[model samples]
Structures are given as structure tokens and as C-alpha cells.
Target chain A: MAEISFPLPDLGEGLIEATVLEWLVTEGEMVERNHPLVEVETTKSAVELPSPQAGKVVRTYGEPGETIKVGDPLIVFEVPDDTAGIVGTVPKEEAPKRRVRLSANLDED
Target chain B: MSEHTTLSDLEAAQDNTTAADVQQESVQNFPEPADAGATETMSMQQALNRALAEVMTENPRALILGEDVGQLGGVFRITDGLQKKFGEARVFDTPLAESGILGMSVGLAMAGYHPIPEVQFDGFAYPAVNQIICQVGRMNYRSRGTLPMPITLRVPSFGGIRAPEHHGESLEAMFAHVPGLKVVSPSGPNEAYHLLKYAAARQDPVIFMEPKSRYWQKGPVNAGADAAGYSPNGSRVVREGKHLTLVAWGAMVARCLQVAELAAEDGIEIEVLDLRWLKPIDAEGLAASVAKTRRAVVVHEAPRTSGLGAEVASTITERCFGTLKAPVERVTGFDVPYPSGDLEDEYIPNIDRILYGIQRVLEYRRG
Candidate 1:
């Protein structure tokens, strides 16, 4: 098994950190790809973070009241060898040619 | 109260492919509704919602697009139930994108669709200024009359709600300055209903401003005789008096009427003029009112410096020159950023400020 650390993704509108509202998964819980892993709230709207791959949640980082900064570890997952190298921003199903809809990484119109 | 969202940041989330999702070919071919009902009391916001529903129903070409306008039914609920009533294919939400929504509307209008795109709030309009000022406002002239761009931009405006910064602003003068566009602000529900329908039916672009402050203010609305009630014939004289012409528009109209009643108690008869059409202002009607009253007080929530109040005052001086018994007076907000929550009362022109204008105008004598 390979351990993978997942950092908080940069939520747009210049929000640097967000308060954790709820944890959708507990440590050692098996989760499928794109399952909502955590609910975090910024000033404008509440957003749910989707897990990148199917894995056993090794550890969860923050309590409900804690604030997590972008690029900080949010969760740790123990994944099979096939799921290694999968990381933040890029969901498992995304292709190199396909454009992600995140606000910051948008290519020119 | 956070830092304003930048245009570049806003532009990033815009999905241009949504324009292709517009399935309808044209609105000109849509069937017209036979029944235009009689008077029913409703709030200004409710009347606006009804207007969008009726227009969407009658003209297959007319569609509404804005943030939270679809499933959320708008933050103000002005577009409440429209998406369900008309179908999401027509009344759909766009990405939290203003420029994208407004820019696509010009193309839709060119393709024979009447797109009633809402900007959500006044401060939000700045992000779409390029689309509004450069594109839709000049589509006809830029392409000649060959392309009759008839898009209606709905903006919820004004203060008194103590809303957050950039959420409440009075930027109508900026729109009114552009020559090719029509600027309209309805004082109450009846006008909101009729003027919206009229602007939708119009062949040119119109900036239909709704005073958010008076959104819940209720009054009768007769859809059939609605057109008969509001003729776009220069402001409606909602209250009649002889002391002076108390001119105001949007949310300020109700306030001016209240101030007029207060002045009446002091034996001053104030004629309240709701300048519904702010662009080609009711110069003739205003002249007539001023000639009759011999004094005029222009009121608005915008800053006094370079505000539309100054324009109204200048216009009165120009049209009602010899007949004017006194210099035109103005009741307006101070030249400062719209203050936050508790400081709103001191910002918006209240009844006392309006009364001061009337009193000042009354004291003036032609020298």
C-alpha cells in the first residue's frame, strides 16, 4: 500500500483558507473516487471537496471548527499501487486534453 | 465587504459553451397571449416576477439568464418559479458570470430572441460594463439598423436595505449617459409590470432598473389596462399639488410623495413627478410642472456632485427659465461611497432632506 497526502485545493474568489464544517468520511473508511470527503465553508459559499480516488482514509486532518489553508494536508489515504501519483486539482477521470472548470486554471477564451 | 471580485477572476468561471445550449431558434414566431388581465394588488418585486413570466410565456424568444436565477429563483426571489414555469431550457442559470450573460444576450437578440438578463445587483454591473457600454448599447449603431438589438437588462438598484457593499448602488446615471440605450425606473408595482413588458416588446435596448429598496412595496396592477395606466408619456403625476414640482424616480418616488404630504401640512402643495423614463427625461412634462409650480426640487440617492439631480436641475433651468419663480433645488446623497449598515439613513436622502430642498426652493426669489 502507498500512502498519499491530499492537500486542500485552492477555492477561487481569492479565498486562502476555509473553516471545516463536516467530515464526510472517518479514518480507515473505504471511499470511492469523487465521493465528497469534506465540507468546507468560505465567506461566499459552502463547498464540498470530492475525493480523488478509491482508498482507505488513513487520517483526517481538521476538526469541524478548524480552518485549513490551501496547500495544507487535508486528508491522508492508503491506496493500492494502481492509484499512486493521483493528486489534487486533477480528478482521476480527467484527460490531459480536457479542461478543468476550476476558476484559476482556465485557459484563454 | 470583502474585496470586490475582479473581472479576470469572474471571467475565469465563464463557460461560453452554454450559449450553444440555447435550443430555441427564434422568439418572433412564438404565440401571443390573448388575455391581459385587470388590476390585482401585488408588491413591486412580485409584479416584476409576473412580467418575466408573462413575457416568457408570450414570446418564445424571451429568456432569462442570471446567477441563482434558475433553481434558486434569484436571491430576491424576483425570478421565483420562472425556471419551473417556463422550463430550464429557457429560464436557465448561467455560471456566476455577468459579462458572459450580457455578451451572449446581444447575439441572442440578434437571432430574434428577447433575453431579459438580470445583473443581480447594482455594484455587480461594473464587471459587465464592457458588454453593456460597448456591445449591447451600440449593437444597432455599430451594425447599423440592420441588427435591431432589443435586449433588456434588469438591474436591482438603490439603497435603504442596508445591504452589503457592492450589493447596493445607484449607477443609473452611467447607463443614462449612453445615448442609444433607453433607461427606465419604475416607482411601484404597476409601473414595474407594464414597463418591463413594454421594454421587452421594444425594438431597442433598455436598462430597466428596479429599485430594490421598494421591491416589497405593494399596489394594484391591471395587466389589461396596465398599458393604459402607464403610457411612457414622460413621468406620471402620482400626487398633485401647486407649491412646487417634487421630482424623483425609482425608490425615491415613494419618499418624495411622503415628503410632499409633510410639506402639504405646512400649506405647500407639492406636485410629485415620477420620472419613469430617465434618459429622454420628461423635459416637456417637467417644464409644464415647473411652469405651474414655479419651483422644482430634483431628488435621488446618488451623490449630489455630477449626479442625475444636477442634470434635472440644469434641465429645469433650461426649459422653465422665465416661468421659474425660484432656482431649482436638489435633494441627493453626499459625494461619498455608500456607507455600511448603520450609517445608511444618513446616506440616502430622507424626508427631512427633501423638505429642506422644498423649503430652500420656496425661499428663493427671482432677482
Candidate 2:
């Protein structure tokens, strides 16, 4: 098992910090990716930040009415070692399909 | 040696020079395995992730710093899980300041740390050009070797993803022009894996242009094998042909291969050469391929005016002048500013345009 932290990401448009309006998931709660974890309000607007990856919530930082800076850990997750938490979509590994078979002829002058 | 001796030596060298001596030295042979041992079918993104993991593991001094790199695992997740695997200190994020990201890397490099900084997107690198070209490129020369800027600046590059105006521009021509910066673009997953590792290991700063469009495309990558024989600074012939050579790099390499396939149906054999390194272009490799085919076409997504294609065409003309059947042709984007996503299909060199380029070269006459 490994512990992964989810930082308060820059919501958009250079908003540096956000105030924690509420926590959607509590400690030891299991969450799936994109599941709402917190509702935070930045200068732009109040937005619900989703869980970046699926894991058992180890802890969530900041309380209602508290502020957290961007890039600061908002929550942590305990996940299996192999699943290594990922944010964006890592395209599934599929066998490369190529119509024009090419060779890497490095030795050919 | 004395100035007089230098002059005499110059004259002696001139006396011994032959037509063969004028040709660019052939690229050094690196016996890359026909099959990378213990290969894993992986996407370019996964390969890059694996490479960074290996780089961090092998070199404690090597760390990655850029916008959204740490907890977020990069905007593309190329640095995914790296912070967790390594640590926050080694794989951390900076604020959305491109200049600061690069500037700090220069300082870190000066202090004996190998920094692998990502500019997030190709368009974002514009804000950091001053730091990249002035400090990162010239630091070692200016310091007279006292400080070597061993930096790997990763920029997700090129169009085809329908990105915004600035996000998909091809900046290889601009980076290749710099005196001290070494530019390399990997065409696929295997190339990305080996090339990124190769760039990170070098003492000089390398601009590693990751082909964003090809990031999701999966291919074989040997995680255990080291990129021993190949020079990341040299080009490689990905396909062999006798009719014509289609010279390209990055996303265009794959496109050219597709063109070659279509051309094959029409009985036209096309060679696709991936010009891996943009700066010290494998002129010898270009000459060797074009000389055999007696025809050539350079394809790129960048605008045609003073682009890298012009340099490539000129090199082929100079080296293969005696044996060439026709002038080198180019299939490239227009001279206008790289457009937004909606207009990308028109801006990037497509298969039909490349086929026309090949046709032009094949049908050229001495008249």
C-alpha cells in the first residue's frame, strides 16, 4: 500500500487559493475517481473538486470555512502499490497497429 | 602549435581534402536491437513516465520541476505518480510561471542538479524563451565549461490534436537555431522512452519535443535495456525504399509512413527517415537516403518560410548535388500563423499533400 496526496489544484484562470466550503468525503471513506470530495470557493466561484483517483480516503485537510492554497495537500489516499494514483487519463496499453512496417536501421550508413 | 604551423597545417589539410571529405560525416552506427529485449507494449505517455521514473531512480541529482507536475502528475500525466514514487522534493510543481520554472532550472543545473522541467505545452514555452535561449543555452559556453547546463526541457509539441492557436505550434526550427541547445523529437513510444533517457543523461541541455498527438499511441518499449548504442543526436531511417525519401520528425514521421503505405499500392516505394535530432541534423543520413533514391521531400507542420525544411532541403542539395535527379521538395504548413484547432487539418501536412510532394519530386525533369 502507498499513500498519495491530492493537492488543491489551480481550479482555473490563475486562482491561487480556495476556501474549503465543505468536505464531501470523510476519513476512511472509499471514493471513486471524479467523485466529489470537497466543495471549495475560489475568487472566481465555488466549485466541487473531485477525487483524482479511486482509493480509501486516509485524511482530508481543511475544515468548512478554512482556506487551502493551490498545490497544498487537500486530502490523502491509501492505494495499492501497482495502481499508483493518476489524475489524467493514461491511455490504455494496446498492441501498436501499424500498416507500414518500418525498421530502425541505425547501422545502415 | 605556432600560428605559422597552423597555417601550414590548414594548407596541408586543404591539399588532402577530396570530394568525399566535403560530405558530412555519416552518422555513427548504434547497433539498436531489432527487438528491444523484455519489451512491454506501452503508450508514449507510459514510456515517458517509465523513463522519468528510471531517470529519478538512477540519478538522485536529477529532479523534475514544472507547472502541475507533482500531485497532478503533469497536465498530461506524463509525470504521473512520479512524485509518489520519488518524493515531493524531487518531483514537485511550481506556480504557473514558465520563466520561473525554466529560470530556476538553470540555477539548479548550475548548482550541480540535473533538472527535467516541462513547459506544460508547446505554446507555454514562449514565456520562457528568454531563459531557455539566453541562460540555458549559453550558460556553459559563457562560463567556459565551469558550469554545464544539463537540462532536459520537455515540451509537448505539434498540431493534429485540434488544440488552441499557441498550443500546437512547431518550435523545432526556433530551438534548433540556438547555438548551444540540442533539440530532439521522439516519433513513437520506443523512441520516446529511449530518447528521453538519452537526453536526460547528457551533459548539455536538450529540448525534448514530445509529439503530443502520438502520446496515446501504443508501441513496444524495453524498460530494462539501456539506450546504449544510439546517439539521440542522430537521425534514423525507420523505413527503407528505393524510389524516394520522405524526411520528417515527430508526428509527421508516422504520417509519412502512412503516405508511404498508400504510395506502395501505386507501385511507388517511399523511404521514411525520422530526423530525430533537429539541431545537428543528420545531414549524412539525409544525403545517404536521398542519394540512393535520387529524390526527396521534407514534410513538417511548421510554416514553410525559413523553416527547418529549408535547411534540410539545402543540405540535401549541397551533399547530393552530383547524384540527384531532382531538387528536394517540401510539403509543409503555410506561412500564416498556426491556426486554432478548427483549422488544424488544413494547416498540418496531411497524407494527400505529402503524396503530392512525392509526386512533384518523382515527375521533375531537367528542363
Which candidate number would show the highest DockQ if scored against the true structure? Answer: 2
Worst 10 residues of 2 chain B by lDDT: B15-24
**Which candidate's TM-score is highest?**
2
* lDDT (Cα, tens digit) per residue for candidate 2, span B1-367: 1322222332333322122321222334243656555678887888999999999888767889998888767767688788777777677889999999999999878766789999988889999999999999998889767777889999999877666667778999999999888899999998999899988988788999998878878788766744454455577888889888999999999888888877877777888899998988888888888889888999999999999999999999999998887799989999998887567778898777787777777767677
Per-residue CA lDDT of model 1 for B1-367, tens digit only, reads 1242322433453333222332221111111133435679887767888888888777666778898787657767788777767777677789877889898898877766678999888889898999888888887777656566678899988887767787668997899898678888999888898889988877778899898777765688877544553465466787888778999999899888777766666667789988888887877778777888787899999888888988898998998888887788888988899886768778988777777777676766445
Q: How do the predictions measure up, each by TM-score?
A: 0.70, 0.78
lDDT of each: 0.76, 0.81
TM-score of 1: 0.70
Q: For model 2, how does the per-residue alpha-carbon lDDT over A1-109 read when each residue is reduced to its tens digit?
A: 5567778889997889999998999899999989999999999899998888799999989999999998898999886534511322222333333333223222322
Runs of candidate 2 with Cα error greater than 4 angstroms are A1-109, B1-31, B226-233
Location of the lowest summed lDDT over 10 successive residues in candidate 1 chain B? B23-32
Off by over 4 Å in 1: A1-109, B1-38, B225-229
lDDT of 1 at B242: 76
